[model samples]
Target: MTTGAIIFMIIAMVTVWGGLAAAIVNLVRHPEASEAEPSPPVEL
Candidate 1:
């Protein structure tokens, strides 16, 4: 393959994988409580 093609592939890979890694890291650092119950509805 050409140099330009190789560079593009590398950039594309980095962008996709970088985004996935960032998402995983963010999820791990700030996880939500799945078992928390919602408040009951209030009557007017």
Candidate 2:
């Protein structure tokens, strides 16, 4: 493989892995907010 292709592949792999790590960290650190009560609908 060309040097440029190898570098691009490495960057892509790191980005994906970094994103997954950040997501997992956030999920573990914070309580799920999906169960919170919704505000009453505003009448236009």
Candidate of highest TM-score:
1
How do the residues 1-29 of candidate 2 rate in per-residue lDDT, one tens digit apiece?
99999999999999999999999999999
Query: Which regions of candidate 1 fall more than 4 Å away from where they truly are?
Result: 35-44
Residue 16 CA error for candidate 1 (Å)?
0.4
Q: Please provide TM-scores, in order, for all candidate models, with all chains considered together.
A: 0.73, 0.70
lDDT of the candidates, in the order given: 0.95, 0.94
lDDT of 1 by residue, 1-44 (tens): 99999999999999999999999999999897877978789999
Worst 10 residues of 2 by lDDT: 31-40
How does candidate 1 fare on TM-score?
A: 0.73
Candidate 2 ranges beyond 4 A from true positions: 37-44
